[model samples]
Structure formats: C-alpha cells, structure tokens
Target: MSLELNINAAIKTAMLAKAEADLRALRAIKAAILHAKTAEGFSGELSEADETKLLQKLAKQRKDSLDIFRQQNREDLAAKEEEELVVIEKYLPKMMDEAELKAAIEAIIAQTGASSPADMGKVMGVATKQLAGKADGKAISGLVKELLAK
Candidate 1:
C-alpha cells in the first residue's frame, strides 16, 4: 500500500485508540506528504526513494529537537520529540549500525581507491549514493574521514 494510505489507516486507528501522540505525528507526516505533492515542480507523486528521504528528513529534525530539549533540561518537550521520532522512524528503512556502516564505507573507500583525506570527496560521493537510506550521512562522512586518515 502507498504510504499515504497506510498513514491514513494509522491515523484512524490512533483516533480510535485516543492516541494523541501518535495521531499528531501521523498527521504531520500526512501534511508533509500533501505539501510535497502540491509543491511546484513536483509531478504530484513521490517515488519510494523520495518518500524514504522525506521520512529520514523528518526523523533528523525530530532528533535535533530532541537533543536541544534534552540540553535545556526540558523533559516534557524531549519526551514529545521522542514520541514523534518513534512514529516517523516506523516508516524509515532499518538503519545500519556503526560497525556495519564502517564496514560499508571501508569497502567503498577500497572500491574508489581513496587512500588519503584528499580523496574524501570521491569516497563521499560514492558512499552517499550506495548507503542512501541505510546510514546517516554524518556517520558515513565521519567514518570515511577516520578510515582515510589511517
């Protein structure tokens, strides 16, 4: 089923269950999807990859907010961000753990013959495309730098 349909069904279920947190997050996803569909230059449809990217962006935003809230000792706000992040992550692909991410970047570095930090751009270009949706860009970049510096 399309993500929109799944989200709508979840919204209905959340409403039935009186799940305020879930309903809020699901509605936010739906609104973002709708906005993307209507945005100029859009073809009124998003590919699966595009949808995954969108969800990842949302999850990243939630993580950033969660971090800031925690820094401020705002437990109540942090909890809300955590709840929303959980809901958003349900739609994202399973992320690669650190070890797996490092291994993958190592292989990409080998494949691209990236021997020094100067080759980071080459490694990043290939790693980002190969690891899209599987790992965070920041993690990949950090790993690439660490590996290349060795």
Candidate 2:
C-alpha cells in the first residue's frame, strides 16, 4: 500500500483510540502529502523515494524543534515534538548504525580515491548519493573527516 493509505488507516486507528498526539502527527503528515501533490511542477504524484524524503524532512524538522524546545526548558513542547518525530520516523527508511555507516563511507572514500580532507567534496558527493536517506549528512561528514584524517 502507498503511504497515503497507510496514513489513512493509522488516522482511523488514532481517532478510534482518541490518541491526541498521534492524531495530530498523522494530520500533519497528511497535510504535507496533500501539499506536495499540489505543489507546482510536482506532477501530482510522489514516488516511494520522494515519500521517504518528505518523511525524513518532517522527522528532521521535528528533531530540530525538539532540540530548541529542550534548550528553552519547554518540556511540554519538547514532548510534543518527540511524539511527532516518532510518528514521522515510522515512515522513513531505517537509518544506518555507526558501524554500517562507517563501512559504507569507507567504501565510498576508496571508490572516489579520497585520501585526505582536501577530497571531502569528492567523497561527500558520492556518499550522499549512495546513502541518501540511510544516514544523516552531518554524521556522514563527521565520519568522513575522522576516517580521512587517519
């Protein structure tokens, strides 16, 4: 089934269960999907990869908000952002763990012949394309720097 169908089912479940946080998150996702469909030059359809990207963006937004809320000592807002992040992440592809990410980046560096920090751009270009939603860019960049400096 498509993400829209899955979200719809989850919305029904959330509504039935009277889950406020879940319901709110589901509606936010639904709104994003609708917006993407109607956005100019979007062709009114989202491929699986596009859906994954959208979900990842939403998850990232929630994470940033959660951090800000925590820093501001707003536990209530932070809790809400955390709940939304959980819902958004349910639709994203599983992220690579550190070891797996390191191995993948190492292979990418070897492929691109990236020997030092000077070749970061070369390594990053390939790694970002290959990993896409599998890992965070910041994490990949940090690992690449650590590995290449050795």
Candidate 3:
C-alpha cells in the first residue's frame, strides 16, 4: 500500500481503538499530506522522496516543540509532543548509526573528491541530495567536516 493509504488505515485503526494520542498524530499527518497536495506549485502527487521529506519535517517540528516544552518544565505538553514524535517517526526512514553514517560520508567524500573546508559546499550539495531521510543535516555537516579535515 502507498504511504497515504497506510496513514489513512492507521487513522481508522486509531479511531476504532479509541487511541487518542495516536489519532491526534495520525490526523496531523493526514492534514500535512493534504496541505502538501494543495500547496501552490505542488504537482498534487507526492513522490516517495517528498513523503519522506514531509514526515521528516513533521518529526523535526515535534522534536523542537518537545525540547522547548522540556526547557519550560511543562511535563504535560512535553509528554504530548513526545507521543506525537513517536507516531511521526513510524513513517520516517531508519536513521543511520554513527558507523553507517561515517561509511556513507566517506564514500560521498571520495566520490566528490572534496578536500579541505573550502570544498565543504561541494560535498554538502551531493550529500544532502543523497542522504536525505537517512541522516540529519547537522550530523551530516559535522561528519563531512571531520572527514574532509583529514
């Protein structure tokens, strides 16, 4: 089944199970999908890459909110954001571990022949397109810097 279908099914399941938190997160996802479809300049069809990007964006938003809530000592809100984050993560690709990330970055660096920090932009351009959902931007940037500095 497609990602959109899976999300809709999950929403129905959540509703039937009366899972409040799950339902809330699922609805949020569905809303995001619909919004994406209707956004100006969008082609009204989301590719796998687009879906992954959307899910990642949603997860990031929740994580940011989670951090803010924690800093404010708002356990109640933090708990809710955490719950949403868990649900949002279900649709995202598994993140690369440090070792896997290192290997991939090494390969990208080798392929790009990027040497020194001056070539960081060249390396990042390729890495961002290739890595996408597999890794976070910050982690990728740090690893690229570490590898290129070598």
Which runs of model 3 end up more than 4 angstroms from their true locations? none
Instruction: Return the TM-score for each candidate structure.
Output: 0.96, 0.97, 0.93
- Candidate 2 lDDT at 47 equals 91
For residue 142, what is the lDDT in candidate 3? 97
Better of 1 and 2 by lDDT: 1
Cα lDDT tens digits for candidate 2, 5-37: 999999999999999999999999999999999
lDDT per residue for candidate 3 within 34-55, as digits (tens), equals 9999999878579999999999
Extract clashing residue pairs from model 3: none
The window of 10 residues in a row where model 3 has the poorest summed lDDT is 41-50
Choose 1 or 3, whichever is better by lDDT.
1
TM-score of 3: 0.93
Clashes of each: 0, 0, 0
RMSD of 2: 0.8
CA lDDT scores, all candidates in order: 0.93, 0.92, 0.92
